[model samples]
Target: FNQNRDQITEQLFRLFDLLSITLSLLLSMWLYSTQFSQQYFIAGTLAMLCYLLISSATNIYHLQPGRDINHHSGLVIFSSILTFMILLIAASMTKTTADYSRVTITLWFFLMCLFLIAWRVSFRRIRLNWFKDKRNLKRVAIIGANDIGNQIATSIKENVSFGYQFKGFFDDRKESDERTAKNLAGSIIGSFDDVVHSARNKEIDVLYIALPMAAEQRIITLLDKLSDSAIAVHIIPNFFIYNILHARWHNIGSYQALSIYDTPFYGAGSLLKKIEDMIIAAFILLLIIIPMLLIALAIKLTSPGPVIFKQKRYGINGKELIIYKFRSMTTCDDGRAVKQAEKNDPRITPLGAFLRRTSMDELPQFVNVLQGTMSVVGPRPHAVAHNEEYRRQIGGYMLRHLVKPGITGWAQINGFRGETKELQLMKQRIKYDLDYIRNWSLMWDIKIIIQTIFKGFINKNAY
Candidate 1:
């Protein structure tokens, strides 16, 4: 019975996805034919593929059916924009832009986006109605009435789209403790062994083994017994142990399976980010070359030092790297016990003062982005002395190096850009860095880049 239910759910989900894709394609075609040319068909196809890839990466499609559509709609929009921009840029670069009509392309984009949003909303409504009818729901039973199991039951009950009929739980503990077993209520069907019997008898379609991780022996024993039954068994791992940020599993070579404690940009995500960085960096370099040359010449004429300053800083994985910036200070300190620039530092040159306040001195790091040592967006790299000073004081400070340091980051834009004179300020910056890692998305990177254009460049703390 469990197997049959799994097959049905799988089929239904596939059908829904197919219908969504079909509707999106039709909308694209209609918009293209009416306004844009046939060339946009290629754009539409590529956009769809990008959406699917990014959606999978972000787990948008894995959301249970009854979940709120509004909560995930923002993610969908972000993914769609990233995909659309990439395709649009690709089309322009290939010199095949004439293949599609501009009107068609515009109309197609607007219509397709609307279609995706509408379809998801409609799908959720239909699934909710089906679940309320109880005609296509699965009878689900919990193995333990512990905190985790109770929480799971509560979530299932609240999320009607999960389509789980709570048939109750099976625990050996006596029901005398009213506080612990209050939520479990009358859902306690039988003992652990009785769950197996009910599953074997095709009474329950799903079995959630929510026993604590410490009960390894009992869990193993139960799994061994469950092997003979046909019920779908799912074990809920204790995720409270580690601060997991987008945790996943991957295989090394053929047989080596390892769980990831950090993000994986080394795969497709890495490739996409790198491509974005290179393109943006190249454009920036071209635009700033003349201005950068003027600044270099001014520094050479006005100050007795090199036009560019190289400072020792912590790079990706906490490794030391030389960060290049337009020389802003008369005295360069790359050693231990470095002091941050104050309101009126005698070391800052006249031109350097203006550049630092305006953030023009950091323009040379676009070259670093091209050099593969930095990203267009990430936690801003700190001086080596600063890294040493803070790592001892800050918890999870080194985790920021999990990815390459960026020209601008979430912390910088939110007023944590420079001079961590206070310990709490550094802690706040590290928190933002971890948040970026926790919710790293291409759309987020783009959003940060956009925000930086308007607000990140000119900050009072920059000097």
Candidate 2:
């Protein structure tokens, strides 16, 4: 019944979007002229197709219950803009730009945007009211009494606006003190058998299985007991035991596989990241071209050996990549042991010390971003020797390589930049790096970039 409801809602959403676009087009056409034009009809149909394709790809039509109205509005505007761009491209390709009236096209685009926003706002209003009513809430239960189960209960309890009411926990373990069990946050309502009985009576609407992966037989038995009922069952996998590194689910033909360690960038996300890197790198390079040239000249004149120093560092997924920097020291250490630059290090020349303090030495890494070997924001790549040494010394240290290294990272913004002479300091830096990877988002990247611009560049700790 829930499946059918979802299917119906999805169908309605699509139909509503189609109707909105069609009505907007019709209104525009009528305002321009009473007579129907074939060119306008063709353009309208193409626009609708563009909207459908783009919206579906972006999941713009999948309206979650109690979803924020502003978020949906943003999606609507984004979809509308993409559709408009597609229409313009199609018109240009067909050389039929002059055939359709500009006023009508403009009217249609704005009207479509207005209609989409209005529809979503109205839907959100009604849905929020529905969610506000306690009687309409779905009863949810969690199986097991472990960490994951407690977390699930806490999440559900905190998100009361999601239209789910916690129905308590169902664990097989017997508690000697009923008072203690009753006082627990996810109050132990009953045993496993009682959960099966409640499901049979249609009391529970959703059941989340948070049992350990080792409890295969017990989980299977519980499934069998609830198989005859309509309660929806979900399993929350516990990957904390193995110390997951950027884990994600993948389907291999008919089998489902869980990747314990992997890069997050895939498909559209990878494309978006590449585009972001290229656009930002190109802009920044254009602005700093002369500055970089001056820095190179200073390095050559002041330092005896080279203008640019290349260091073999670990890149994405632990692959070796040559990192570029303005030679900031008298001795170029690209060997087995590379010492980190210190505040009063004698190797740093006069000009080199100034560059290092202001972070001008790392400007060449923007070129690395353009090369697709680095990101504008990510875990800063350590030298290969440092990576090898730290991986053994620190737990989950190597997971930072799951993403492309950055010029400035979350660790840098939070004062973890510069020399790490102590193992504990490296551990703290690694902790921030892993946190950045685990919580990576395009907005998060942009935020870090903005923060870097404001405060990350000039640090007293950068030699």
Candidate 3:
């Protein structure tokens, strides 16, 4: 039901945005007493095009219901700033900077920002007030009375602004006995038969069948019963029953299929991740090139081995890649029995200990990033020996390779770095890695990178 509402709201928003941009430009020109010329028309069109592009890319138009008005306004303002920046870039590239009035441009930028913020805040208030009386709310019912069903009920109850009126659960077993019915929550209203009865009577608007995949026959029967009604129905699959790694649904031609094991980096997301890795890696490499060279020299003078230690490690898709680090240990162990670096280990050179402690040894992985073998942010790669050993010990251990290995990762920043002596410690590390893959957003990656700058560099566990 929210889909239809959202579609309508989005269409209205697009029209409002276009009108706001046009009026803001005209107002700006009038305020600056500048004649509206052909140049002004060209500049206005360019600005409007940039605004639409930036807004769509940043999700400014796809405003979700029940968001904080302040946060919504901030996003609008930010999008406006980005649009202005793009317009400026376009002007510079086209060599048309002199054709536009500086005063008019400045006024238009501020005017547009003010109007955009005002429009969203006003729209939010109006929408919230209209839905506050519950007249526009949809009547919803859940079919199952299991854990996932209860969780869904609780979530809907907590988020009242979702405009859903929870009619209650419709489980057949729960309503069979008077004693069991009394112990159940007040939301467990009736049986499966009552669900069909209510839907036919138009008492329910949306029905959620929170049944497990095993109950295929029961689900199909309910589907058949509800098919005649005008009510909207949805199935909440219990994917939490398994070790789901970034599980999602996709349309393969005409058929809808779900992925039990998947990667989030697909389509435009993969390109965006690449761009992010390249830009950040290039900038960081520029900053640390001199220091990396100095560290290389120090390693050569203080150690008996190579300055750059190219060890075989498991990379994306569990492929073998040469992971580069400044050699901090006496031996290059890439064999099946490779030992993790321990506290003050004998194999660690004096300089190597310092490098590991400061995490300077991993700096050369930026080259791995540029080589496209690694990302600036992702699950940190492990040795081939470790991968083989842990793949058997830990569940979903190999899922980390779904994305490219990173120089710094979610686990490393969250105190799961260094030697994992206990199997539980390694399990916890893999949990964080899989979690990263599950919720891999550009903002999350940026947050991890910022956190790494402060806390990830000097971990006590990295001996």
Candidate 4:
């Protein structure tokens, strides 16, 4: 079943690539007919090449077969935009801009985007339908029935498009007596040796070695025994044992290695983030220039201090950065004795209270985003004094600086925004920050950004 499924998935990918190329060619011909220029054909073909290359670089085509299209749509859109911009730049540099009609190019861009989206949606539907048929699914077994294993099982159950038929778990201990196997319900089939025998007999298609990190010897022994079998193996990293923020692999020279503690913004990720920030910041600045001017005037009239408040905060890599915000207090605090504003704090001006509540005060940070000191979405930067304080109290507070700080973040959207008055609150915020890093994706960033637009700006805890 697994071999058949793999073959089908491979065929589907080949079909997808062929369709993409065909569509690109069709669109190019349409543009040529509309504009009637040789240069336009060249430009369109170059654009298609750019899209394919960037899509590959971003792993858009390398997604797990059963993954939902909606879950990855944001990455698709982002990569598409990156591809479009690269093509546009290339066209401009080659002075081929005049060959393509602006209207036709615009239409082609929208059409290609629609084509890509439709293809992914169709693939998702087809995969889901195949899973429902039950004839093409892979039989999967878990090695351990612990929390991590159960979590994997739950995910497999939820994502039916992955076409994994859970064949139950294998543990050394008795089912009822095993604490780790308890929550797994009835998924346990037999002992570890039984799993080996089943694999040898081609009963299990895939085997997940979900053992805890402490069982290194047991894992090694299991691997030795399973070496003769044909089942695919995967290791579920025990990341829960240590706090990780944006952990990922890095390549130094020709050696690729994992980083237990790291930032997500590196290489293509950094470049993509900067491009996103620049685009967003530029649009925001254009749209809100007048509103910002009015707010500046209001702040100048309502308060005696400067309209913009610049405070010291930790940026990416623990670097000192001057974070900008609309002045919201009678007195600014950037020192060691900084105090968080509470409800009806006397230090907050009347306008400051309103700005803080509505998150209007954060608008100026778009400048920070443009200045390369921050991102449009990431772990929010804390005051340098607060950083100094929390680094001692929280286990991984300093790790938030792994990436550039953002105007809004997962913690902010999840109601961990505003003040961290207690040690527990700070710890909770750090936990979310680290989770964001561990599960970093372009789609996740877009989700957080959308959530922030709808509900994060008006949080009751913002004050």
Candidate 5:
């Protein structure tokens, strides 16, 4: 079925990347007319090692179908920058920085980054053109006209670069059966017997069985029949019938297991997220310390309450934490029925109105980020009272707690911030929040942070 071609493509990409890294360095050295010495060799080796390691972490070798270059090139650039930093650190630690030529190294880094990013765009275009050849396309047939089968077909149809030419659905149901009419979007190509016949005739390359787990014996019989022919078969899991939230499959002992409710930040991802939060939060605190102090003084003078307002909010895994905000209201509300601020809420002090509108009230939550109770980017937390109110009212409301609450988030950057008085507004915000968690990546966090700096800070609906 050519399913294993992905691994082959990945290995090919790795080899190409290794050669480009080496060749880029050589090109730089030749341009500078510098002789290749032992120090340069060691430096180049270290750089290659660092880049390969970082690229693996970034999943740069996936080369999957429908990979948008704009969505991924930032990560390639990020890996390049990280590799450069590690190389610099290595040279400094070993006290060998003086041995390398700066111009050569700089040129090499730029060329390597350029080549890595450029090749992805070029390769995807080339692969798309290559897939246009009918001979290279895999003829796929699905054995069931179920929901799972339909979804798989939809995905394959949308992603043209998958290089799969779907033949049609095959089912054993009687022609007059109501299930056939209900489930089949198009007319079935033939019965299950016809599937085996097509496989034997080399007309179908890949077959996906989407029968329910209850039909184990029927599936076994079909598999036994298909085993006579050289064809690849896959089964779509029934567990997908449930709401899938970061579901993953793994081998547990001699058996397979699937985790339905899981966080994206597991193991290395957790460490990376923590490191990202710490570094960014620390750097921000340094720059905004003076402004924070000024804001605090202004809050104390303008309002009767404490400078920093505290409220309970859900953190990662539904753990309650004290969220800090500059006191932007005269009344401190943190009860079972705290109210949302409106446009002309009288409890808002004069300076508080500006703070709320500008989102300066959220500045103190940067401390929560460093304290590990929050992140620079995530699903923004709501007050405990409002959270409880919506927890039952919303379908996947609690899912947002899969990651730490953030000072600013995907919702904020997308203009989903401020008071969510209407149910639809909050639902849209929750949708974006879940989307962020589903597609969490270091580059995504960086993108959100950059966006927040430019436009997320000042929102008309924030109050």
Candidate 6:
């Protein structure tokens, strides 16, 4: 049987999006006191064609793993922008730019993107609350007792709005086998025979075959048995589960390559990240320029060093970047054996203590953000000495360098700012940093920036 579940979901998204596009264009027409014209109709048709192709290619309308509300909104806006640009390019090529009203095109672009995001959010909220229908809810079962199977179960359990009710797993392995389930929902309730019986009885709506490739014959046998039930079944490939952090497919001359330890900031993702950093950094730099200048002057008068201390730190892809901050210490330690600043350390001047406590010392780093050496929200770059030392001792420590360093970060906001003297503390900080890299979005960055404004600054841990 085909996947009626995903088919129905995709149809709903596709239909609603087309309707939104049509309505947005009509509104734009009404706004400009213009009636429908051939040019307008042509533009609209081309936009819809571009959207369908791009959206389908990117799998935008489908529910996927690791796609949160922000992720959905980002993809929708991205697809809409591409559609708008394609239409503009087509118009330019046909030398028909003068045929359509610029005002109408501008209004349509704005309204289309806005309406697309708004309608999806509104639909999600209403579907979850106002409708309260449970017809689409499916009872799912996994045929494997492995890591990927358990991960799938966890995803289903967590995304309650997806309307999946996991009905435990099915495995033939004995209790002593290493493949037995661990800490998963419901645990192994039955074997393959039981799963088939339940499927035939109409108790199981969806079946996920997460068996290893080595069990090809066993999988074929199971598939043959489940063929009679008419229940939808899908296979969970082991390769896709090998690494989940920033995992995405790349096409190289018609070949698919999976990057295990890769950065998310590539191609359009890189542009989006830079745009986010630039806009936020510019706004912040304007607001704090005066305060940063005052802090720089204070450091100059109090400390016997440069007002702006630049130290070597690892940036994106482990590139050495000169990170900027107001010199809050009496000495500038940029050497191989830089010391971690400690509370009441003699190296810290009186003014430096207040600056660090209030996080005014980091104000200068906003300039670094504007200069593209850093980001407004990312993993904070450690001292070159700290980075080198921890890379050897801490697992996945160097992975934090996958993104540009930042003035404020998930780690800093979660009280990992200031000196991490203990190895365990540094490990915890790196963990949060990696987490941020794994699930970064513009909305996530904005959330961190807002959190930083309220409570991230003036942390008790800050020296």
lDDT of 6 by residue, 68-128 (tens): 5665676677678778888888889999998888898899988988888898788778756
Best by TM-score: 5
Q: CA shift at 251, candidate 3, in angstroms?
A: 16
lDDT of each residue in 132-206, candidate 4, tens digit only: 977698999999888878888888877887788888889877666747555673367888889789989999889
Looking at candidate 4, what is the lDDT of residue 216? 91
Superposed by TM-score, candidate 6 places the C-alpha of residue 304 at a distance from the truth, in angstroms, of 9.5
Deviation in Å, model 2, residue 449 alpha carbon:
14
Candidate 1 structure quality by residue, lDDT tens digits, 227-335:
8888788888764433432465567777654444475477899999999999999999999899989999999999998988998888988888888999999888887
Error of 2 at 161 (Å): 5.0
What TM-score would candidate 5 get against the native?
0.70
Writing each residue's lDDT as its tens digit, candidate 5 over 1-463 gives 2547878878888888888889999999999998999988988888889878877776777666776575457666777788899989989999989998999999999999888877877888887898898888999888888777877877787787888888878987764687764655445789887988899999989999988888899899999999999989988867444335355676789998776656889889999999999999999999999999999988777667799889988889998899899988888899788899988999999999999999888889999988889988899999899889888888889999988888888888777888778998998899899878877899778767655766788998978
**Model 2 worst lDDT window (10 residues):** 175-184
Among all windows of ten consecutive residues in candidate 5, which has the lowest summed lDDT? 239-248
TM-score of predicted structure 4? 0.68
Give the alpha carbon lDDT tens digit for every residue of 1-463 in model 3: 6688878878788778888888999999999898998878887787778777766655666755555565455556666776788878888998988988899999998888888778877866676677677779889989888777877777776665677878889887755555333433346778888988999999989999888889899889889989999999988866465445346887999998777668889999999999999999999999999999999888888767689888898888888999889899898788688888899799999999999999999999998999999999999888888899999998889999999999889899879998889999999899899888887888678657755765788988998
The TM-score of candidate 6 is 0.56
- Clash pairs, candidate 3, are none
lDDT of each: 0.78, 0.82, 0.83, 0.79, 0.84, 0.81
Which regions in candidate 2 have their CA more than 4 angstroms from the true location? 1-5, 30-36, 62-67, 173-185, 240-314, 319-366, 375-397, 403-463
What C-alpha RMSD separates each model from the true structure? 9.1, 8.7, 8.0, 6.5, 6.5, 8.2
Best by lDDT: 5
Q: Ten consecutive residues with minimal summed lDDT in candidate 6?
A: 238-247
Show where candidate 4 strays beyond 4 Å: 1-18, 21-37, 65-68, 82-96, 240-291, 294-322, 326-361, 369-378, 383-394, 402-404, 408-463
Query: Runs in model 3 with CA error above 4 Å?
Result: 1-5, 66-78, 175-186, 240-276, 283-368, 371-373, 376-397, 405-463
For all predicted structures, in order, the TM-scores are 0.54, 0.63, 0.63, 0.68, 0.70, 0.56
